[model samples]
Every structure is written in structure tokens, then in C-alpha cells.
Target: MNIKKGLVLGISLITLFFTTPYTPADDKREEKGEEKKVYVLDDIVVTAPAIISGNEVNRLGSQVTHVTMEQIQDLNAMDLTSALRRVPGVVISRHNQVGSFGGGEGGAIFIRGKGSSRPGAEIQTLIDGIPKFVSVWTHPIMDALNVDIVDTIDIYKGAQPVLFGNMAFGAVDVQTKRMKDTGFYTGIKSGYGSNKTHMASVEHGGKTERFDYYLLGGYRSSDGHRVNADGELQDLFLHMGYDFTAKWGMDLTLIYTDNWADDPGPIDLSYPSDGRFNNDDFFMVATISNNYERAKGYVKFYSDKGDIDWVNQEGTPGYDTLTDYKNYGIRARETITPWQKGELMMGIDLDYIRGKARFLHPVDGNSAFPEETFRIFSPYASLSHTFGSLDNIYFIPSIGVRHLNHTEFDSETAPQAGIILGIKETRLHASYGKGINYPGIYAKVQDNLWMPGDNRWSELEAENLDHFEAGVEHRFSSKLIVDLTWFYDRGEDRIVTSPPPPFPPILTNIGEYKNRGIEGSITAIPISGLSLFGGFTYLDSAPDDLPYAPEWTFSAGFNYSPVDNFQISMDTQYVDDQYVTSRARMRNTVNTDEVDSYFLVNGKISYDFRLTGCDADWQVFLAAENITDTDYEQKKGYPMPDLGFMIGFIAEFN
Candidate 1:
């Protein structure tokens, strides 16, 4: 079918299917006649960077999706990465090799088919309001670890609240569980999955009259399916809170993560596509946060660092490398209510980041690519006003500016405006925002440092984007909630690496490019004990296609609990044609064809039980991924494996 025809038919089919009701699952219940009772919608979706507590499923918002703790646990997910797969419009790429012990190339994620291929640094990850960077390009430090201590994960598919940090090309916020009021509590869990994958974790937390604390430790290992691809991971998490009084409080958190395994480098399936390599990365972070409700303000200070060791490069010793990074920041924010239905939020944020890389001979270590450091000072604010319940109208306007001291780059500003109109059970919204991205260490090193004739380094401007979106959400009943959104984005002056010429263009400082696109998603739970979620995205870039960005992508799934404590779930996604690399000359070549679309399946079952002195539960989970055993690559030439499974248990003590 032609592109236009396909698009029309796709929308018609989806709309028709949703309009027709299905049999309600007996397990579905209503709260005060509200259909969205199973999950609280308002508490679920994070409207802005400011942290708000409540049930997300019931939260009234636009272009947002939330995954609750119960939803994560019921699936018996192997990691936080997999736990987000069920979220509509979100695409998660996983390593397919059975023996592949470490999480590597094939593992990644994309939101609305944007920023997925770029190093993960562009995608913002917030842990309890603190901005987090995952080893520059890879997944978060906690991606491979267990989620035993997590409370919930909220995804804002577009520009989010101004306080979280201006880095989110596509926003993701992760919130960890906190210590309860109970005197003391502890829990432990163990599980076994396919490929000899075993996992275990211990978590405990308690609250004293003046202080509260929580700690979690976990370990996971596997004898991977690939010949040399086996590895292990260890994780540690700690959180503590102190209440000086009813209006003053402080919270602190520390995290340590480590992963090591044979790389199992990419395969050239057409040639000799099998080889073993080594991959190891370790990360750590420390943060402290203080809040004063009476003063209507808060502040935070934190630092993050990491190192990577890649044993096998395509063919060079300089290919072997270790990198270090340090980030320090301080932010102060406050909220004020000038009128009954109007409020203002303002903040000042300052951050300094520095890093260095050491590589072998072929890396040209003698070049002028010295260690680098940069600082950003940003101050921003927003004013929002809400009408009465009858009108249910909300209008918000905001702006943020970043000043970069190094590279002699001038400052840049981003502005945003959004409005929401609620009419009984239906709500409509429209928003426009801007985003800016500065060059990272890798960009500077490859472009300006090595290129002999490229004098445009200092002249390169930070990439910028103008985003616009409009959508509507309707509540047909308590059990049936649906949302549809349309977005158009224009990218301007995007820094891109130019190809090498007679003098070999520098690696870091590239020229520029542009991109534009449309995207949307649908989330619904038509019946009790069952939920159906799906989403599709369409994108057209200036260069025909963007790397790792499928022109069209989608996911559909359902979850059911036939009996108490026993649940079953399945989900699948279709990613249309996508480019593995950014080279325009080879964009349509057969080499990139390996990363075609495929289907994946997951399932599980858990039983609740108790022993004297122990509140325990046993869950047996079986996840059959790539059920057809189709050999496909989510990343170029990186052959992913087929058909795999896992099983696990949990016990709590007082």
C-alpha cells in the first residue's frame, strides 16, 4: 500500500476497534463511579519537573503515560529497561544473543521515534527530581539492576516541567520507593530464568521519630547463549531522610552499579558474523536534597562519575579506552500563589561538568584533544493559572536560558506555552516549546581537535528545536479511558559531523542539519483485570530517515489476572524500516536491511503465600522473547537471538 493509504487505513482500524466496547472483566471495579479507579490518573503522570504524589492512571493530563509498581512487578521484569516496554509509544531494544551476558549495543530505547539513535545523553532521566546521565550514551546505571526498591516510573512524551533540567529531548522520570512509617521492614527475593540467568535482591527500610532510611542490594548473573557472551552485575542503593520539623526536611541517596561480560561483538551474518569481545562499565552517584515548605523553596547538590573498558575494538589498541566524568550542580526553586487559581514557579540552576579520555596509539593521543570542562548557568520560571471546575481551563507560560562559558559560545534561550481545557469527561490541550543541546566531549574531540582545516569549531552553534503539539483525551467510562495526540517538531541548526575529505574533516565539530515529524499514542483499559495499550509514530527527516528511527513504529498488549495473585500478559511492537548508521551514501543499501521489524512476547504467573514470621510470595515467570526465533538486528549487523525465558520469588520479614 502507498504511504498515504496505509496511514489512513491504520487510523480507521484503530479508531473503529476502540469505539466498539468489549466484555468487561469481572475483576474490574469502580471507585465512586469513576471508571479510572484501578489507577489514579492525576498522581500517575508527571505534568512538570516538580514531584507530585498520587495515582498516575487517574491523573488528568495530555500526552503522558505511567507505569505503576504493581504493573512492573506483575510482569516479573528482568530489569528497569524491560519494565517500560508496556508503556504506549515507547520502544525498547534488547540484546537477542542468548549467551550475551552483558547489556550492549542491541539494548537501547526510543520515544516517539526521536533521539533513540543519538547517544542516550540526550534523553533525560530524573531520579526523584535529580537529573541523571547514563555513561554518556548507554542506558541508565540501573537498567540491568532489579527494581525491588522502585515505587513508580512516569513518562512525559514531550517537554516536561521546567525544573527537571533542560536536557530532555524526550522526557523520562524514575521515582524510587521511600521508607514507610512502619518501625522496620525487610524483604528478599530470588529468581531463575532461561539461559541459566539467576537473580537475587535484599531490601529494607524503616522510619524513626526523626529519621528514615532505605537500602537495597542485588546481584544477577547469566551463562549467556553466545559462545563467549556471559557476565554478572551488582547494584547498591541507599536513601535516607531527616525531618527537622513539620516544614523542613532533607533526603539523601547513593547508588553503585557494575557490569562485566565478554562483548560478543556484532556479527557479519552474510560473512563470518560470529566473534567474542569484552565489555565492562561501572557507575556511581551521590546526591543530597533539602526542602523547606514554609519558605516555599528547595535545593539539591549531587555528583556522578563513570568509566568504561572495551576489550575489543574493530582492530586498534587505541580502540581500548577508559573515560572519566564529573558533574556537580546546585539548584534552588520556589512556588508562590499570587492569586486563588494562579501560581508561579521560579528557579536558579548551575552545573559544572568535566571529563577526560585515554586511548591507545591509533587514537592520536598527542593531538590537541586535551581534557575538557564546561559550565552552564540556567535560571527559569513559569506562571500558570487555572479556571474553576466548570470551565476547567489551565494556561501556563515558561522560559529558560542557558549560558555556556567554554567554546566561546553565546547563551541560548528556550520558551514554552501550554493550555488545557476540560469539558466534563473530555479534555483538550495544546503546547509549544523549544529545546537546545550543547556539544559534548566526544563531539568536540572528533570535530574541532583532530580536523586540520576545519576552523568552524568555535562558530558551531548549539542544536535547537521548536516543538508543537495538540491532543484530546476522553473518559467514556471508568473502565474506558483514551488519549490521542498530534505533534510537529522542527529541528534547526543541528550540529552534524561532516564526512572526511582530502584533509579529513574533524570528528567532533560537524556542520548542521534539520528534521521534522508527527507522532501520537493511545492507552486504554476497556475491561476490569485487562488493559490494552498501543501507539504509533510517523517521522520524516531532512535526510529522508534518521538512524535507528523507524518511519513508523507501534505496540499493542494486554494484561489479565484470572485469579488472585495469578497474572498473564503479552505485548508486541512493529518498527518499520530504519537506518543503522547516519551515512547518507549507504542509507538505503542492503547492509542496513538487517535491522528490520520483528515481534516479541512475554508472560508470567505469581502466587501469594506466607510463612510464620515471614510475609512471603512466590512468582514463577516465563518470558518467551522473539518467540519465532527470528534472527534480526535492532542495531546494524548485531544479530539478536531468539526464544528465551526466566522465573523468580519474594519474601518479606518484620
Candidate 2:
């Protein structure tokens, strides 16, 4: 352990020493007291910053990436996973194998090219103020939820304010729509896409006197392109708010989701593969909140249950089973004050999870049940202060600690700090923080497969990361805006699994690695009714090879409104070579190959008209993806679909 820690620190120091950019924190001490702009990084871009900006670009402590609800609606996005594609520093991957290997579209979302490498939860997710992480088996589990429920998504890419508590390795907070004080709304939408995919949804909201409420429901199903690959999804969601008095208020929400998919066999090139796979999931949540002048807080509870069935043809062994999981927590936060120059926020949170999965071998009628459970208790706080000429600069520092009751892991504390500096029209920012992820039920206790006898949860290892990021954001004119960021991450004691010899070969022991990258983006509203947006990402990852970790990613788009009710838009994405791994082996032993980079183009056109009597507006649109139909592969032996089309319509009430 001593030698390993020494090596990790040594490597981190060497890597950091070579990559650090000299940004000259002092403007007055430049070149023997002479002031002249000298380039630090080879490439620099200037652009209008997004309305919701971050500290990374401004020399502040942290950074916040923002996506507006307006943009989400414009794209007619199906889910949060689909809508995030437009963000600057994100990548989405799909496994397009033949039969049973294709149910995970919109299942993988990566920020900074580091997430989604293995099955276990790699990042922390949040809705409102709640901390959430999906089970490894169903990565990207929120796909069934509609994006219409979101008011906006705020991504604090690096470390965040202290109030967030531990788990900032990539913090993402989603803000749901709030009830309006005096208006009513109703909307319905339906759509059809290639491969027999269909979707329909309805949502309504209103306020009566002092009470406001909203309800949403949707159904979607698809007979996918591959054999035996089909899926069906249904969702119901609600939000309500009331004012008990002028100084206090409460909000409530309830959600239920069900998903079922026919498993397609893994990739088969020779003939065709045959197999059966299916899954079902259920979820529920309730929350209550209060407000008082300068302080506010809330608490919520969550629960879920799911089942899975898998079968192989030709007398081969198959598995069928049901799984249940339940989680409940109480999270309360208070905002101290918004003084003349700065603001302060602090909070406390706690959570507990209990889960179990049962397995059955159908051929011999054998069955077993594995007990998996854990409880997590975390209490954290943060502080933010701003001061400078005209309050143009701000600094934020945060810290958090968590206690675990599990035997495989020990208690841990995480601390972070960042600063943002504004000079004239340009801003600079930098921040550093630590993060840790706990082992899942399957990794430490049970291997799910029948071949196990107390694999003993392979001593849990905490992954510690120190992130250093800096960037410059500038706006030279009204029409053009540019933003650029550079980031370095050092991961210690990275947990990785080894292939089985006498034990079920799943994720196993403690490992380590390093990741570093740069990102840049630009948006231009050069002319009235015409707009352009584009961005690029460059990354390098080490140790275990990851399939979706592309070296280069780029995207560009143009939107134009030719007339009052008609609009046209086109976008393109470019992905460079990536890697794919099939089995466990030395990082160097695996066969290395390229995915052949390609550009994908998509276009859409829409027209809006009014419907009589209902006081409604109608929209009709068509979308063409992969206009070139360029063939590509994200996983070995699996070819993605070509030239897909989708047509959709929507109605909204005023």
C-alpha cells in the first residue's frame, strides 16, 4: 500500500508539472512591470458566454454549465440523455449489436469522457436537492423520463459549492419546473420514427387562488431494428405547491415509471443469434419543503423495484429472476443571506438503501436469493463570498464528510475550493476537489451468477481525485461568443474488476489511473432569425481501456426561422477513433483498434398552425438523421442503423 500510494503521488506530480499553464495571476506584474497580452495555451477562443455561466472560464473557484428549457423544447428531445447531446462537454454512446444487445440506446452519458467505463455507478446524479445513483445493471436509468418536466439543468463540471456536500467528482443538479402564480397550461405531443417507434405525451398545469399543481403522463414503445429487440415505456409524474402563509410554503411530487424490453442476442456475424432477455422497473418518490424569509429547506423519500429474465436457445443454460430495491432519505438545506456584496448557503442530508435480488435457472428449476443492503449517512456544508472592484470577482470554498456502516469500506471526508476572477471584459477561474464512490451490492457481496461462494465483496477501495481546471471566456461583440477550458484529473485507487478463474469474473479489486482533457465552444447569433452553435472536446485516458472514450469530439448546428410559423435547423457531429474491449486482460494485452471517425448530419423542419375552438397551436415537423448514412461501429461486430427518419406533432394551449 505504501509503495502504491508513493507511485500514484509521483506520477500525479510529474503529470501536473508538465501540463500546468502559466496564467499570470497578477496583471500588474507582467514582463518587468510592462502590460501586454501574451498567449498561454496555443489555442484561445472568445465568445458571448451562456446566460448561466461558470467559474472555470472566469478564473473563479468552480464552473457551471447551463442548458435552457427553450433549447430543450426546440430540439423536441425525447429524454434528458438525448437533450444533453447539445451541451459542450458531453458524449453519448449506444451499443448497436444484433439481437439481445440493443436495448440500451440513450443509456450511456459521459461528461469529460470519463464516465460509463464500467457497470458500477461512476458519478452522482441529483434531482432538485436529492442525491441519486442508479444500480450498475441499468446505467443511465432515467431515460424513460421526459425532459419537459425540467426547467433547466445546471452542471457544475468540476468541484462545486460547499453546500453540495461530498460527491462532486462531476456534480449535476436538475431543476424541475415550478408552479406559476397565475396561469394555466396544457400540452400534448405525438411522434413516429423509423423502426416502428411511436411516442405520445400529455401535460397540464394550473394555479387556483393560492394553490398550484401540474400533472404529466407519457407512453412510448418501439419494435427496434434488430430481431427480438423491442421496448415499451410508461410514465406518470406530478408536482404541486401551496402557500400555508406568506412566510412558509410547501411543494409535493409523485412519480411512477415502468419499462419492458425484449432482449436481443449479442452480436452474431455468421448466421443469426437467438436468445431472450427482458426487464421491468418501478419507482416512486415524495417530497415536502418549507421557506422562511432568508432560509429554505426540503426532505424527500424514494423507492424502486425491478425484475429481469434471460434465456439462451439450444439447451444452453438460461437465467430468470426478480429484484427489489428501496431507498429513503431526508435532505434539508438553508440559504443564510444575500448581503450587499455576497451570498451564503449551508445544508444537511442523510439517506439509506435496502435491496435484494433472486435468481432462477429454468432448465433444472433451481433458485436462489441474494441479500444486498447498505445505509449511507452524509452531512455537508458550503460558503460563498464575493469582493473586488465592483464585485467583479468571487471565491467559493466547500467541504463535506460521509460515514458508512459497511464492512468493506471506511468513512471518508472530501474537501474542495475554487476561485473566479473578472478583469474588464474577460474572466478566469480554477478549482480543486476530492471525490469518492461506494461499492454496489453486487460488487462487494454477491456476483449474481450461480458460480459464487462468498466472493467477499473484494475489499472496497475509495477513488480519490484532485481536479485542476482553468479557462477564459470573453465576448468581443454582440453577435459572437466563445468559451474554452482545460482540465486535469488524477485518480488514485481506482477500483477495477479482474476476470474469474474460480470465481465469477466481474468487477473486483482496487486499481488506479489518470485522465486529462480540453474543451472549447462557440455560439453566434450573427443575424436576426439566424443562429449558430458549435463545440469540440479532446481527451486522453489511461490504465483500463474504455470503448466510448473518443480522442476527439465535435458538433456544429444552424437554426433559422424563415417565417412566423416555419423554422429550419441542421446539425452535425464528428467523432474520432475510439476503443472497444470485450474481455478482461492486461491493459496492453487487449487488441487495440480504431472505430474509423465519421461525420453525422441531421436536419429538421417544422410548421406551426392554430386549431379552432380548443384555443390550441399545432406543430408538424420531420427529422432526418445521418443524411449520409455513413456506417460506423461503437462496439465490436455491431453496426449502427443508417439514414433514419422521424415525424412528429405537438399541440399547446394558451
Candidate 3:
């Protein structure tokens, strides 16, 4: 599809979806409804970020982070990277203030040194366990993920080979909000900040009898800190659902995003700059789920399509480029409790990826590449059972495997096992899993276009990872909690350019590395309406110069309501010096120069007053970021913005 056509469709479709009538047919529908049945994990998708709560512990032996809507509001975070910055072992690289730019650190997320490679990333982005990314490129497009409808974001800190297929080395799950109350509601919020930054969003949602729906639309823009750095995002999300019966229901979801950001080249580096990276992404998901006393399951079908336009590449052959891609899949899982304290889960996944790219102005004057496609069918299952003494002591041991059936490559079965020991409110867990990422068509595009004549991409193999993790959490009291964890990953068979090429450009799977780290966090509610949370991480990576892997990081924050209708929140963080690398074709080399360590502080304060005649309130808020005015860089030579602030207001009513 043409880039212009895709952009038009994205904008027009979003408008149409958001304009759907709010009122349901048959206005007199019965209001009586049965209590909702608890759905299994296989059916209920979720999202959160930073410091998972003790009460949310159910993953047995995995490390997870949780951040809620209230916390996101407190942080005044506008995107995934900002919202998740405080997550342990997490790092992000971005060149602009607003949207995520193109490849090469323009927009990227990393976890313990993984996911740094664009077009072949290990970290996966998901919405309700459904995979969402650049199908042809094989990595996530950050701009495509719209945060306007997010209720929470959950970060699973390591490989989840059994539960999630493909790019499961690490994962981010975004859980959209669902209406709970029986009355219709509306919300509006807008803000203006430093660098001509402005944003506005509105939403409507409600639950009625056997029907429920949520709809949202938003826009954000900024004149960034540097020339050609401006960016903007427009998005819409809608969800409609109806209960077929007390135990079964169905939901249809639509999400669309059109966003673009420009790259402001490094100050110290002299290179031809790529001016802008634009994207139009859309997604549709349909789900049918059921719940019963001993069994729960779901079947989901999803399609995600996107068009990326590389507006400029000043000196490269591909001066202007466009790539169109789509990903579609069907997944289903059944979770059953065959006997008391015992659970079994079985599931299957089928995925198809395809796309094509064209250079509007190739320096070589040749701009055609045939479209390609890849297919994979994965089936997995796991079982867990609890064992323990009469009281206060018990452990759940689990095991599972996923067989990858790829149409273009040999298959690999990912195996995972774990054990979780619980002593009352304190729990200890350990787990190990294997992860695999097939060499998608992205690799093919690279070799066929850049290799001139020697295309070794056809011989390239899949990358593999062996991961192990262990942790312990102790809840001293309902008001205080602490958790700590350590992990090690062995990565091998990674596809890479034949190093320091002198004559031939060859891609091989000889790359290998080991990464280990320990991270811990604590959350405390010292007094009524006051929350305090802190976390720290230490990493040791061999081939030690891993890109974006910092040695030490720390974060702490507090939210307090000192008086009625008034609130205050403050957060601070520190990042260690780290190397910046590049993954452009044969230029895949780690930069020796390290970006220096830096400290940052951010805070927000708000006050709310009820509207006189309606069940609504308007909240005015003030937020400040980089309060220390520290000069730092996330990507080498890309200096961050100075201290700045924003003023905003939010209103809601039923």
C-alpha cells in the first residue's frame, strides 16, 4: 500500500470508529445481570509497570512490575518510555521529546540489555497477550502503542517462553481499562508544557446490564528541544462487548494511531541526517471467552497493520523509504482445574507476517524489493500443583513447553519450569526458560538490499536464549512490602554482521553474550494517603560494552494527600554511564565512548473541586521535570532537555 493512502486510512478510520453511536439499541434492555465469573490468565489480558504489588502475585516464579493509572497520573508520563522509566532493569533511548523516531535509538526500549536491536528485537510488546509489533521489521514500533486508553502496564521481567511465543525474551503488556460502574461516564484532560508541548484527551465508558463499552480519542504534540525535532501523535481506541450468557461473552476492539517524529542528529557527530520517521498503525482484536467452576478459557483473533515512512536519509542511497506491513494471528487457550489445588493449561498459536519496502530515491537508482511472508504455528501447555504442610508453608511447581513450527526454518521447542515456595505472606520463587526468535523477513530485506551480491541471509539461523531467575518477596505488614530478585541470561546464535568487514558483507549467527543482574524494590504506606516507593538495580554484562546496559540505577518516589482535595507527588532517578551502539547493516558496532551518568527529579501537585450541579470534579495540576536542570544524554550526543514544567487540568463526571 502507498504510504499516503495508509496515512489517510489511519486518520479517517480512527475518526469513524470514535464517532460510533454511544447509545445501545433496545433502550429498555433488562438491567439485571449475574455476578461476573473469574476468568483465567489465558483469557484475561492485563498491563502494568514498575513495582508489582504483593496482592497481585500469582505468576508463581516470575518477576513482574505494576504501575496503575493513578501512578501514571502522578508521574505525568505521556508515553510508555516515560511511564516505565522507574521500572527495575529497564532503559529507553529516544531522540525527541514526544514521539518515537526511526531505528537506531530514535525510539527503543531495553530490559537488562535486551531489545536494543531494531528489526530483530528480543523484547516483545503485547496488548492482552496478543503480539503487536512491526511484522516485517520484527521489532516493536513504539509510536503504534497508544497509551490514552491504558489502565495499567505490566512488565514481565524475563523470558515467558511457555505463555508467550516468539519474542518472549521479555515482554510489556498494556491492559486497557474496562468500565465497572453501571452508569455512563466521561473524562476530559489537557495540558501545555515546555517546548510548545500540548496534549488533550477525552474518553467515555460505561457498563449496562449485559453490555459494556469504552471509547477514547487523544492528540499530543511538541516543538522539541532542537531543530527538526518536533513530533505529534493522534490516536483513537474503542471496545464494545456483550454477554452471551453468564459464563460466556465477546468483545471487539479497535485501535488506530498516526504519529511521526524527527531525528535531530548528534551534536558531536558529523553524518547525513534522517529528518523524520512517520508511522500509521491500526489493530483489531475479537475475543470470545468463557468461565466456569472448574474451567476457563478464551479464543482470540487479531490483525495489526502499519505503514512506516522514512521521510529522509540525506546521504544514504535510500533517501526516502516506505515500508508497509501487517501481522495477523489466532490464539486460544484452555485452563482447567482437574483436581483440588491442581491446574492445567493448554494452548495453540498461529502467526503470519508479511510486508514490502521501497526506496523512493535510491542512491543506486534501483528501488524495488519483492514482498515476503513467514508463518509460524506454536502449541504449548503447562501444569502446576501445590504441595505443603498443613498451614503457612506451601510450594507450587510448574513446567511447560512450546514447539515452534516454522515454515522457513527448523523448529525449536521452548521449555520452562519453576517452583514457588510460600511461607504465609512471604514467598520465594525460582524459574528457568528458553527463548527463540526466528530470522524473519527483515533479515532477508537487509541482505538482499545491502549485500550487493553476496547474500548470506538465507543461511542465517534463529537466535536463542537460556534464562534463569530467582526472587523473594516479604510483606512485613499490610502497609509495608519488599521484593528482591536476581537473574542471568545466556544468549547465543544471534545474527550479526561479520565483524570489521574488509571485503565481503556476511551475516552470521556467531554473536553470544551473558548478562546478569540483581534488582529490588520496596513500597510502604507510612501513613494514611501517603505512599513511598524505592528501587535499585545493579547489572553485569559480558561483552561488557552492551548497548544501553547501565551499571547502576536508582529510583524513589512518594505520593501524598496532605489534605482533602489536594495531592502531591515527587519522583527521582539516577542512571549509570553506558555505551551507545548502532545496528545498521554492517555498521553494527558498539561505540566505545560512554554516555555519562545523570540524575533527574520530577514532581506533580494537583487540587480538585466538584462542579456545582453534576457528579463531576475538575482537577488542576502542576508538574515539573528535570528539576535539577541536569544536562544528560540517553543516546550518545543527544543531549536531553533542561528543567521544565507543565500546567494542566482534568475533569470527569457521570
Candidate 4:
């Protein structure tokens, strides 16, 4: 670890020394009205500073979906699941009603048919470029990711070793809001919906000459659609930034979430009692950044801690479980234009995690909790070159590699490359990459205890994936744009559960799978104040019947403002039939069968008004989800709510 750190530091220093100095001549030209143009990364699209760029998105080497704050507001999204479902190639499954406990433990997001029932295994979630996942289960808590506090979300649908290390089948980077102007602003929002659900939030931000800060606090509660399926959640987010110089700055972020829910056991179960669980989580990150004319860099340190408690009320004397987890990490990255038409990026990541799970007996004493610790180190680099245009066409190519070292497993390397060709308003791109996912703590422990005879624990290795993709993007006119992409992924030595006759299931790395899909999207502004968008996806997988791997998914939406200060929007989504297995199916207790395909319609309307004699704006809105009241089951025995409505008002003061 020390050696790796030393090497990173040495390289940083050398790059710093070789950086081209800012020249007075450049400043003079700018002062004389010759503004320097920003060089955006090829094919990348972003509304804020990020590791990737619009050029990168355009290059089509990798498939990316960029969601902006405006879009979130338009949808009136409450959480990650709602916002992400609108993206092509992305599918989110939730159990029970909207805010029920099953929504957290049973919910999952699949990107190009890659995600598993487990959380953090298939996709990695990041907050400001720092990973956020429970150390104990190694999965993301979707409820904890409040959409209100986020400014933008960048979704990468394939391997991204250059910017993110392991578990990058699908990666999401969430950037929070920050104050930019030297003035104070505040906002308040509140709403109510079906099942006695209610939500409220307050936010404030300000910026001064050298400092800026943002704060938000919110709460949501619901009496779920099902019996004994109630839940409540509270969250807080804070961000502060300070500028030390014109080219250097530092930022600090803190987030906390408290959630409690009651889980109604599976529908087929005859149990009369309800199981309950609670989670209290906290996260903090501090970063220092440098932004020069031709270079950018940042160093960050982060910590996450969570406490979980669960009570199973299936029997007269229920059992209780408690789990505690802690994780800390450091991340550093630098990007520099070392020469004409060329850019280089390098980064390093280090993480340490510890967790313990305990079972408490009511009459007897509590059992000893097995505590475990893990450490990981990763270093990576990427280089890209842009070839000058020929006949008004431009070409760019890039290559990257990442090496990961795990304390308990063999080290591995991931490599990736891509090329993009662009002419006028059209771009064609292709890319190939390798990715890896290590065994989660739970998988590791289960292998050790249940598979001791086979000693599979000692022989367990990281899962590997190879990804290939090609795509094209075009802007037919100022009013219309379209994107189409095709992707293929192959996995080997995947960790899966094996249930043998008369024996409990065990974790083993003996699974192989394949997924191939085509995703397409189009956006059009047919007239002033009117916007239309639609997306569709087609997926084919090995085992051809993998549950929740929908063969077809489609969505279409439009936003229109017929008059000033008023706006209306509507959207519809359709999903094709897919196989699914429920507790009843597994136990042969009932035949729930495959999940039936369904279609849904949603709509919203809002109007803005000014506060006379005050620097403030007030808005009132009404929104409805599942307006069609479609009967659907993303998860069996967990029917979704039928036609939920919310009425809310927002006041923004400047």
C-alpha cells in the first residue's frame, strides 16, 4: 500500500512540474476579447464538472445517460428509482407500495440486464465521484438517495475502468447542488399522496466571495398499500466549499439518513405478524481540487457508517438481528493536456471496510457476531488523442487500464479502448472493455461456513466480464436528436447460489452468463415550449429466461407550456413479459408464474406566480403516478399501488 501511494505521489509531482505555466500573453489575449474556448471531452455530456465530458458521450465508445436537475424537477422525482426508470436500458423493480420496507430490501435496478437481486454487485453508485454502498451487504440503499438534493446524475451503462474501478457493469455518479452566486436562496416543498403518504423538505444555500454552502433536510412517510407495510424516512445533506485561490478549491459534504419500515411477509405466508427493520446511515467526504487552464485534479477522503436492526415476527418469540458497518476510503485523480491534441488521466483508490452481524436471543444470551475486515487498492490511467479533422470529419481514440489488489483475493487488471468518428451533426463510435467484481462479504462468509467440505471459500475468485458496444448519435436538426446503441456482455466465474437436494443453498463461483441488447432514444422540440422524448430497449440473455430480464421496454413523454408561467407534462411506459420466481414459486406453495407485462401513464401540471414586492417565486403543482391504475407486479406478491396522486407547493426566495 505504501509503495503504491509513493508511486502515485511521485507521478503527481512529476506531472505538476511538467505542467505548462500560465503565461501573461494568454491573459492579455483574453482581456483583449479573445476568450479561450473550453475543450470538452469527446462524446461525454455533463452539466457540471465531472470525470467524463460531452465529447466522451458523443464518441459513442460507451453508452451514457445524462439526467439534469431540470428533468428531475419536471418529473417531480422523489428518489433514485423513479428518475432512473425513464432511461433506456435501465429497469427498476420495487416491492409492495412506494414507501414500503420491501422497496429497500427487495428492490433492484438492472442495466442492460446486468444487475442481480443484490444491490452493489452489478452496479456501483457514487456521490460526487465517491462510492456509496453498505459495507455489510455491499449494496446501495436506494431510499437513502434523495433526488431533491442532487444536481445531476450521470449513468454509464458499461465498463468504465478509466474513472471507476471494480463493479462497473453500470455506474451512476450523483452530483449535489452547490451555490454559485453571492446571494442567499431558500426553498420549501411539501406534498401528500395515496396510502396516507406525506413528504416535506426545506433547503437553503448561499455563496460569498470565497465560500459557499448548501443545506437540505427532508422527511417522507407512508402507510403502505398493504397491511403492516408502513415506512418513514428522514434525510439531511450539507455541502460547503471554499476557494483558496483562483485555480484551487476545497469542498466538504455530509449526509445522514434514518429509515424505519415494517415488512409484511410474502403474500402466500400464513404468518400473522409483521417483520420490522431500521437503518441509520451517515456519510462524509472532503476534497481538494485544482483547475488550471489545461489541467484538473482532485484529492478526496470519505467515510461511511451504518447501523441496522431487524426483528422477525413470524413466530411467537421473534428473533432480533443487529448489524454495524464502517467504511473509509481515499480517491485521487488528475487530468492533464500533456501535448497538443492529447490528454492523460491517472487516479488511485483505496478502501477499508469492517462489519459485524449479531443475532440476539430473547431468553438466552446474544450470539457472538462474526467481525470481518477488508482492504482494497486500485490504480488506473487513461490516454486519449484527437486527430485533426479531414473533410470536416474528426476522429478520436482512447485507451485505459486499471489494476486492483485485494487483501484476500488474487489481484486483477482491467483494460479498455474506444474510438469515435464524428462529422458535422453525426457521430459513430465503438468500444470494448473488461471488468471485475469481487465477492461480497456475505458471499464470502456463506462459502466459508456452508461449503467447507468443498473449501470453495479458499478457492473463490473475482468474477470477470467482457463488454462490447457500438453506437451512433445524430442531430437531424436543431429540433430533433437521436441515439442508437447495441451492446454485448459476457460473464465468467460469476458468484451464484446453488441449492442441492435436502441441503441449504451455498454460494459458489461457478456461473456464466451473457447479455446482449439494443437501446435507442429520440428527443424533439416540435414547437416553442413543447418537448417530446421517447426511448426503447430490446434485450436477449443467456438462460434466455432470466427473471426480470424484459425482452422489450419502452417509454414516451412530453412537456408543454401553452402559456407563460404554466406547464403540463405526460409520460407512458411499457414493459414486455419476463419470467420471475417468488417465494411461493420456490416453495411450490403457489403458482404466481411469470410477471405479466404492463403499461403505465403518468401526468403532472404546475404554475408559477411571483410574490409582489419580494424577490421570491411560488409554484403549486399536482402529479399522478400510474394514472391508468395498471395492475402490475415488478415483484410477485408485491402489487404496486394503483393511481397515486400528490399535490404540492414550492416557494423559492432569493
Best by TM-score: 3
For candidate 3, the lDDT comes to 0.78
lDDT of 4 by residue, 101-217 (tens): 432335556687776635237688888888877776677767667676777677888877667887777798888877766666666788898888887777766667888877777
lDDT of 1 by residue, 1-654 (tens): 012323323433443333212221121111110122332333323111111111231122235566656666655665666676545555565553222222334444556545543432345666655665533333343343335546766676654435444555666766776654535555567777667877777666666677877767666667776644565655667777777876667777776656555545456444332223233222233333343432366677767665544443554444455555566677777766777766677787776666666555465543334557767777777776667563354443333333333334667777666777767777777776666666555555555444467635566666566667777777676445556667766655655545545454433333233444455444554445555555556655554545555667666666666666665666666767676543231112222433677665555555556555433334455556656676666666556555776666665544
Ten consecutive residues with minimal summed lDDT in candidate 1?
Answer: 25-34
Model 2, residue 258: C-alpha shift (Å): 1.5
**Could you give candidate 2's per-residue lDDT for residues 1-654 as a string of tens digits?**
002223323433443333212222121100111111321111122211222222223223566676646556566555665567656667655532112232233255567645653444454556665554444332335443346567666676664425454445676666666545455655667789988877777766666567877666666666776665666656666777776776566677665555555544345644344344444444455555556556565556665544444445322556554455555566666556577545455555665655566555665675555555566566555555666662354443333333333334777676656666666557666677666666655564344563355544555555566777877777555456677888887766555555556565445445555678888877677666666778888888774365556788888877777677877777778877776532221222343644677787878788889755545668898977678999876555556668878899977654
Estimate the lDDT of model 4.
Answer: 0.71
Pairs clashing within candidate 3: 47-152, 47-153, 47-154, 48-153, 48-154, 49-66, 49-67, 49-153, 317-363
lDDT of 3 by residue, 286-323 (tens): 99988898988889999998889887676454578888
TM for candidate 4 is: 0.87
By TM-score, the better pick of 1 and 2 is 2
Pitting candidate 1 against candidate 2, the one with the higher lDDT is 2
The TM-scores of all predictions, comma-separated, are 0.80, 0.81, 0.91, 0.87
Q: For each candidate, C-alpha RMSD in Å?
A: 11.2, 13.5, 5.2, 9.5
Would you list the rank order by TM-score, best first?
Answer: 3, 4, 2, 1
Off by over 4 Å in 2: 1-60, 95-106, 132-140, 159-168, 263-267, 270-282, 304-318, 338-342, 363-367, 389-408, 447-458, 497-509, 581-594, 612-614
The lDDT per prediction is 0.54, 0.57, 0.78, 0.71
